[model samples]
Target: MTDSPEEPNPYTAGLEHKPQRDDTFYYTTVVFLVEGTLFRVPRHPFIDGSDVFRQMFQLPVPDGVEADGCSDGRPLRLEFIQQNDFKQLLKVLFPHHSQPQKSSPKTFAEWRSVLKLSSMWEFESVKKLAVDHIGTMQIDPIDKIGLARDYDVQEWLVPALNELAKRKEPIGMKDADKLGMELALKVAAVRESVMSSYSGYPLQIGERQAGHIDFTNAIETMLTTLENS
Candidate 1:
């Protein structure tokens, strides 16, 4: 009699692996690999705050694809992002305090990470919160300008540039490197104009008026002109 075809090994057969439900959490857990570190966080807050995550979760899973969990299950992989940045972002998204804390990020660096990830993921509220916190920090004017421009924080841009313009010392090579050559040159020019025109004039405060030399307006105009030119 013909030898019966070798039966397929049950263990070898392609099967959707599911991890044991190990955690006693109230909500479903979604796992992410950030910079090779595994973070198993709750799904609700991410889904609620991030349009990107919401869309991702709404997508139909492919046939035989296991849901995201641990290795026994499928852990969602987020590549090319630092684990610390992701951790900071999660802190903002899921704060430890039941009520809003007076202090969010203790440092500018932490807020920067939150801003980067929140903006990338289109977490608008979180982005706004990060921006607000960043606004209060004592950051270098050049760095602040960069962050403002990058994140489209319009309110931050004029003030930061004006602060740079008002500085007694001209933009150094290091700061110029941060602001790029074009912006650095523009800032230098504005500083010269402000020094010459106003002499000892204090930095303009409040909203721009019709004819007054408003540093904010000047910065805004300079930026507009640069963009157009």
Candidate 2:
């Protein structure tokens, strides 16, 4: 007698996707593997927040090829990404994203993680949120310069460098180390030139300008020179 035929498994090891888990209209989750960690979270947040993810999810799977993010055995791999950063991103997307602005308990470092990932993924809204949250922070000028450059925060460049050049507290060894040799040197040069130009008779500069030493033009010139060089 002929033996009975076996039923096909819909979960994995298939050439084509056959709707295994979370195939509903609204409730779907994508599995991601990031630096040896596994995260299974809501798929909609990614689709809504990032065009990259939306485009990826929209790509049609070719015949005879397996799709990723299907189950625990197979997950979408996030290369060159820190698991910690992914965790921080998930903290906001999972259930806390709908809450009020700046409501999450994330620290500065965690927000930075969000910034890094969001920037990389082209999550414009999420990136803006990270930037806004960091705006309220009390980071120092030197550190702000570094953060500004790292994150493409153009709004922070002028204020941070101006503070660095105008502040009475001389740039110390620790400050130099923080700003790096080249930037520290530029800041020192600007301060010295400004001090020399207005020695003895201080310029009124302006009423609202107050005690400021007028580092705007000098900083801009220095920045131009730095850029050209």
Candidate 3:
């Protein structure tokens, strides 16, 4: 047996060659307690992906006081967080490297959760991934508007607004509640303007309003102006 080929990546062979720290390969495990559940994961993702985590990690530990994530007794306690949401985030941040697709978030709600947490924690990469995934699917326009506002999803904003402006149905009470009084009134105003202009006829789905394609641009400009106000 050709002596089991050097088991794996060998370390610096000679003593004279002092071992150097490899930043590229460094990893530390951290434990977090979410909703009374313990989750131990590689610390690098948290430290690297989120400004919040990076700042938390950089804070110096007091003499003789163990870091919160160092042990079970003092694991980082994340508050106001749903354990399922945290788990969904972990599925993105700490995937099953060997079988990545196995741990991939597939459902629309799953991606939304990832987007929410990633945005909240300032994980730009994960946030982008969530945004892209959501882009591929259809979402309720009112909900999308709320998401765009809460997460600063600039691209989703105009498109969702355009959908709302161009759709046939008037905003319902529940949807109006979601959109808030100001925006609901603005949308109603837009629908009224378009309908009244079209000789008492409602705009059909996928039809250019009054045979003018500039309707979306008009809606976007109006909404942007209102939002900024």
Candidate 4:
């Protein structure tokens, strides 16, 4: 009889067995726990848009190590972020064409959440988008100043502060609280000086509205003086 074929090498045989494909697509799935709810989102947007997520994914996975839900075919869990905030961020990062109306956040609160989360996560593009939306919105001047300062949108600062300075009434306690005492005092003083100087006489329709022009000029002058001084 022909010599029995050499016993198949058991280790090599095991190595030769190819594992069945689980899925055709090679996308990573991440799970987030937000306010007791679980969010299963694709990892691509996070990896591409956020430096925080990029570095997290780059960490080495130890042999045989398993994460909850991950072993049971669920995404790996990410915790600590608020659900509403994460949802708002997802709306910006992965807008769906089917819901064109909801593709981008329209309200100030939603964009504020987006800005907060995107900024925290270092999602530069999403942060920029949030900033753009917030800049164009009809937010209260004092609130706009706060947002501009928080987001480093310097272009919004002077215009928002100028609007506050031009208001006929004194800045309210609530608004002053938001603006803080020093800036609030400066605005109050500028408004007082502008009204006293600009309101003594009425002008023709052809002439510049003195209150408007003078207040605008005075605000600019005050800001310039402050900068120079």
Candidate 5:
């Protein structure tokens, strides 16, 4: 009779990625150990294991999966859990991405940071998330005059420009008139398109422009507003 390779408890294996109770909501690394046979498991489910255990073990193990796990006694599973987490984070950050105009900010600024990081890394889904969030706003002076100038969120550009001449003047615009005017024209075009697509009247431009705004500035402002005195 041939002896079957040991099927170690996935929960006990060094390759197993169970999340600690204290780290369930945050990112946590897990280790698993299997003496002979190997298998892949997901991250979040392992973190909060409930009914998923049965489903994972039921799936047939693919060839070469064992070889990959047993190499040099240091198993590195290819489940790509980080990528999955990032993808889920994108959904949380930009829920209304396709609609553009109706999306609201997620409850936490962590979502915004995730979107920004995703954009910086050129992650397609992450970029889409940021764009969707930007599209919903009325384009405050800071976004129109500062962050827009650097980050290039194309969706907000045209609406901002359309109302530029009438909107409250941003500080130190005297030196950047040409570039400002150029952006204003682009914003006008974008605004027209947005208004045509939506049923509501266009948003009004405000007179008081925010000063010295950046991504961090926006985040700080939001945090302050959230923590009312």
Candidate 6:
């Protein structure tokens, strides 16, 4: 009989790494949740399986979005999901509310404008609209800050600042301190932009009137928050 070649050992050679079920993976699906609900979503690009549902699958996270956050609620996160989920969320959020005013055609900027107006009026339904759909709103800190300034929404302004502050250390920006300083400068710039439109005076001269001092204080406070946090 011919001698058989020795078989390769399985223990230390020819070992293959198998990904666990919880490995980060992507899936494209219709994403139907409750009865009679459907979400239009693009194919998944990338997302962490560990925090998929809690972090990445949110309505506002644009596709292929990335951010830093744990499975638990933390500072900042970057993530994406389908547009359908976003729309479904809005429907559920404002079931009893009036439909937003129709613009000539739908555009992302239009959507932002609508939200800005709604947020300013403090209409219960409009607030609900933002609440329901803000999760799906793909906005960066600069844009959030700018929009809040342009629209004069005090409520949304500081929170966005704080959110960015909380995440600054984790965002891996080119220079954290410099980034904070730049953001402070941006606050100053926004104050300048809004000053041209300043109307309220004295007693009401605050976020509603492009008050530079207030914006400066807010930016400073955010920097402090990030430093300590």
Candidate lDDT (C-alpha), each: 0.76, 0.78, 0.82, 0.73, 0.43, 0.44
Which run of 10 residues does model 4 get worst, by summed lDDT? 202-211
Model 1, position 49: C-alpha lDDT score: 90
lDDT of 1 by residue, 87-192 (tens): 7887776676324662356689999999999988989999999988898889888889899878788888888887776665657899878898988888776665
lDDT of 6 at 119: 52
Highest-lDDT candidate: 3
What TM-scores do the predictions have? 0.75, 0.73, 0.81, 0.70, 0.32, 0.27
lDDT of 5 by residue, 1-229 (tens): 9999987776767854754565445533323333333333333443233233234434676776653333435554434334433433434443554255424445324344545545544455555765676556554544454545455565554344434433444434552454555444433333232211113543322323322212233333433553563
Off-target runs (Cα >4 Å) in candidate 3 are: 1-21, 97-101, 195-214
Give candidate 3's error at residue 148 in angstroms: 0.7
Q: How close is candidate 4 to the true structure, as a TM-score?
A: 0.70
Q: Give the poorly placed runs of model 6, Cα more than 4 Å off.
A: 1-110, 117-124, 166-183, 186-229
- Quote the positional error of residue 115 for candidate 5 in Å: 3.2
Q: Clash number for every model? A: 1, 0, 0, 0, 12, 6
Candidate 3 achieves a global lDDT of 0.82
Worst 10 residues of 6 by lDDT: 70-79
Error of 4 at 227 (Å): 9.2
lDDT of 2 by residue, 1-229 (tens): 9989978866665657665464456577789999888888878889989989999999999897767887778899999999888877777666455355544536889888988888888888888888899888987888778888887888888878987776766667888887877878887777765643255665442222324465878888888888899
Using lDDT as the measure, name the better of candidate 5 and candidate 6. Answer: 6
Model 1 clash count equals 1
Clashing pairs in 4: none
Q: What is the C-alpha RMSD of each candidate to the true structure, in Å?
A: 8.7, 6.9, 8.0, 7.3, 16.1, 18.2
Best by TM-score: 3
